[model samples]
Target: MPEDLPIGRRERLLAALRSRGSVRVRELAAELGVSLPTVRRDLALLADRGLISREHGGASARTSAPERRTDGPRWVVGMVLPSLHYYFPTVAQGVKAVADAAGAKIVLRGSDYDPVVDREQIGLLVARSEIDGLIVAPELRHPQAPEMLRWLDALPLPVVLVERQPPSDFFIEQLQWVASDHRRGGETAVEHLLAQGHRRVGIFGTDNVTGMQVADGWRQALRRHGIDPDEQLMGRTGLFQRDARISAFGDVVERVRKGTLTALIVQPDPDAIALAQRCLEAGLRIPEDLAIVAYDDEIASMGDPALTAIRPAKAQVGRLAMEVLLHRLRLGHDAAPQQLLVRPQLIPRQSSLG
Candidate 1:
């Protein structure tokens, strides 16, 4: 059998397992004349299909039928996110990719940036016992977040959070979550600015949890560079309040003119774009007068001069959230809760070329 063909390799692996009852990964790799990773992947696929049972360093033939329902009852997973547009659609696509591959049905719902709505949507899924697991991206900073998480913890089905973490005060041992390293993204942006010789950098953050983490990263980066963080240089704004964002933009421009800030990091693409426009209107050239870095690379490239941005692995987060929930569903209460953080990449553009 040719090892180059996956079907051939898998068939060979099954034959070897059937004859030997069990086989170590290295032994299988040597016998199949395939790489260790290739053998491991084949073993995983066979295990996923209930054809074998995975062991510590090997796999064994299943003596009885796998616990999965194969006749008619398909695994149904419920997914809830904040929005279907911008930033979340890619995540939803990732989730769908895994669900489709696993032959599981996904019931997706969108919430309106409100924790109450998140609770309502999740409750609806819970009431329907047909749902086997849930993947949710709720507004964890909301006032009702603790109560909502408490309620979720009590649910019988497995739940995995997407891009959200529980409050520091809450003790949730069983809760699992996947999120981007926003704080590290912030620090990376500051490091890039500092590398470009920008002193007295500023941050325009949002009021959300993601924004808070970015700000924390920014602060840490500044301190590491021996620059004292200025409270006046850090401004917080609401996500969708146009008037408030405009005010914050004006404040940033004023600081730039006063020579208090040479570079700035604005979060969530919209605010960054607005600030860039305001800077241009105020007769300040980007990278020359005030270097700019935007978080959430969604629309950063669309800006004039193409703003430098932090690109979070949102799709990976979504896929991992689904995978985690599925693992919990399969392994039940014995599965250890997973806290995964995907790192963001820094995409430099003309906006921060100085």
Candidate 2:
């Protein structure tokens, strides 16, 4: 969305197709200071190169119009993310950079955290896009996850999970994936706090796969230090719902006041910031009265105390997942299932250091 996006004519044309899902030759010609015939020629070359499909009056990305030149891109991939916002955009950038450079087509979609929507968007990609592979971060924690995962396993295409590892309780054969080591991130958070002489630690995260993983690590780290990972200290609530967070703030404040909790680990920057604000209102000093560690360091420093945070290698996960899917596509069903984990790093600031 830069002001100079329309500069490189061919690259710009392709980017337009990718972003808008289609582009008419006339509009592209007028926008690019070129003639209709020149645009048509470029479109033909691109179609022949397999980068796009030549439509009746325009060009379309694979997601909008089926491919006519299957011989262009080495592979056509469909990517389904949890959402288009937050941490996933960086991940998508990594995926696209690799794919575009490698002459591979990728169709991107967001599921908004709903498993049903995830499956539906994926269905459209499969049925209309003619994708040869998939890179997805699905809602694997849903009740319908078992069925949806089974459905995915049955697909003829190569599939790689990004930022999500399949649940072990299920019987789906080994799935290829690349994910952040969030469990270790949680462990690191606790270790940092405990090393600072805090024993009565706690966790508060949004109720999701990530929260669960971080909490799991917190428990492991605490038990290793002979401290109990009490249920009272770790709790899950909403990421965006202000009402739910207000109630959680009251509960957490009560615990801090009663001396049951001295430090906390919170996932996501916004929730952590919100918690810090609530603590300020209650006259509880960060790190002095309540040390904190936040997971996902996107804007974590914006908090009043400049929170310590866990930074996941989001772009690395995306790039690696895309690369793995390309390998899978080449090897087909004979390829070994790959599960890769990237570590998350802890950034210490006033929140925990003070």
Candidate 3:
């Protein structure tokens, strides 16, 4: 019998046995540059721990008791947004569908567009150990994003961002997210306006990440047409304070005076309808005075003039977001992050043209 070996030596011996199936005491001694007695003692400890089997003056791989592997706890998904209204519900639908297929449950937490609330929700999830993973559409951008990511990373769980890009120009590029191609959506929206013979197309949207991206898309489309993206024609004032209604009203009033704004692409349909109603009250006619196109056809349909809008597959986005999350959860934290972009469709209606 050999004397007790150090923890490191025991580990090395176990690893060798696991890899090579079995090892003679002499061979283990020679491989680890230790005495035969020391190798035998190390093997004995491992065998006692049921990590190996000692026999024939040597050791073999542990085959009697298999190492346990668990799927961890049931997955808990976190969502940070204003509500389960028009867009969020669609995304939730997709997430839920995929989660069901993957044998996971979701814990949706609406932050009501508050970062503090989002932070608190994350703390709750971590403290409770209720969630194994997170798919968040952050209320704010990068510095805030890194904070959330760092916290989740420490817990050694998977976290995926859905339908948002980080705000601060910092490490947002490094994070993973699933979102629609708003730039292309903007281009498509503007192109639709142009096709209807309106050159001076105005765009309206919120100051959030999705809104900014759509605004950029609109500008890029205008630049592609050799039209300079004029700041005056753009209406997003402050990134935080600008809502769809306020921005739409500002755009309507500002452009109406300049008289260069002919057609418009409003990211939210409600805003477009509000502007149209304002215009109507001001004695301006739709398609005659100003042709408007809005995004999210479902929301746009509520107004008097059924809006021509860019309709991304709402249910599909939700379903696909869930699919992405499920795939991430299955792969675990060691897996590489993935980014998915859903395409958009343009729905023609009476607001833009007859």
**Local accuracy of candidate 3 as per-residue lDDT tens digits, 56-94:** 889786443122225642555655555666577887887
Q: After superposition on all CA atoms, how large is the RMSD of candidate 2?
A: 12.2
Ranking by lDDT: 1, 2, 3
In angstroms, how far off is 348's CA in candidate 2?
Answer: 1.0
Steric clash pairs (candidate 2): none
TM-score of each: 0.76, 0.75, 0.69
Candidate 2 lDDT over residue span 9-66, tens digit each: 6556755775577889899999988899888887876665444779999988643222
Q: Provide the overall lDDT of each model, using Cα atoms, as 2-decimal numbers.
A: 0.80, 0.79, 0.67
Candidate 1, which segments miss by more than 4 Å at Cα? 1-67, 71-73, 238-246
lDDT of 1: 0.80
RMSD each, Å: 14.9, 12.2, 10.7
Candidate 3 segments exceeding 4 Å error = 1-76, 152-155, 166-175, 236-259, 333-335
Off by over 4 Å in 2: 1-71, 238-246
